[model samples]
Target chain A: MVYYISFILIGIGIYGILTQKNLFKFLVSLTIIDTAINIFIISLGYIEGKDVPIYSKYTPVANFVDPLPQALVLTAIVIGVGTLALGASLLVRVYEKYETLEVEEIAVKEARK
Target chain B: MTIATIFVGILMIISAIYAIEAKKMLDSFISLSLLSLLSVFLFVIMKAPDVAITEASVGAGLTTAVLILALRRIGGDEE
Candidate 1:
């Protein structure tokens, strides 16, 4: 159920990326895509009734949910933030150079040059 | 748990759609942030506290701030 939703989110993001004219809109779509992927990975580790993978005196490893995906997603969240920041900064430079965030305009300017 | 997951999943998809289809860039950004928050709830329902915390802080918190700052610098509208 959630898996299919993740796929739908990815499709929406892709549609936005392909159709949007603004660079910042494109970046937002990219982040949405990244988020869908993250959700899919985290969902892959879910086990019904399993306790979180916190090691404690009463917690048994047998019933603990998978810890690996959580760790991976932790790293992924930070990486996603870094990627967003980088993309935003690059958009800033593009705006400075082209004086517009619209890709069609930039392409037109390039063609005239 | 399944019901909770489904609810959050639906919320996430709805917000993602809004994020992509909204007219204003700031509105789209806010929708994206809402999407992240829904995902955080989904993470918690999935029994991944670590991921939930990370997504809340980075996705809903810092990413929105960074995007907002960028929008402020460039101005939010495409025109």
Candidate 2:
């Protein structure tokens, strides 16, 4: 079920990226895709009736969820943020130069110049 | 628990769609934040507390800030 949801989100993100003319919407779509992938990765490690990987005196150690996917997702989240920041900065730069956020307008301007 | 997880997942999809389809950039950003918040909830339900905290802080918090700042810099929703 979670997998299905994530796949649908990925589809939506791709649709947005392909159809939207605004540069900022493109970045938003990228963020959506990043988030869906992260969710899908974390869900891969989930087991029904299992506890989190955190250890405590009362909790049994054997029934904890798989920690590997969590670790990978942690790294992915950080990288997603970094990329989002970079994309946002690039959007700002593009807007500064083109005076518009529409991708088609930017292309036309570039062609004339 | 499964029911709750499914419910949140559905909400996440709805918000993701709204974020993509929203007319104004500000509305889209708000929907994006809502999607992030729902994902954090879903993370907690899936027995991934660490990822939930990280997402709540970084994904929901920092990402929204960065996008809003960029929107402001671009002079907001000219269309």
- Best by the TM-score measure: 2
The CA lDDT at B53 in model 2 is: 93
Model 1 per-residue lDDT tens digits across residues B1-79: 7787788888888889888888888898889999999888878888898889989998889999999998888765664
Worst 10 residues of 2 chain B by lDDT: B70-79
Candidate number with greatest DockQ: 2
lDDT of 1 by residue, A58-101 (tens): 88456888888889889988988998899999988898898898
- Go through the candidates in order and give the clash count of each: 0, 0
How many pairs in model 2 have backbone atoms within 3 A of each other, for residues 3 or more apart or on separate chains, i.e. clashes? 0
Q: Where does model 2 exceed 4 Å of error?
A: none
Worst 10 residues of 2 chain A by lDDT: A54-63
- For residue B40, give model 2's deviation from the true position in Å: 0.7
lDDT of 1 at A1: 79
Clashing pairs in 2: none
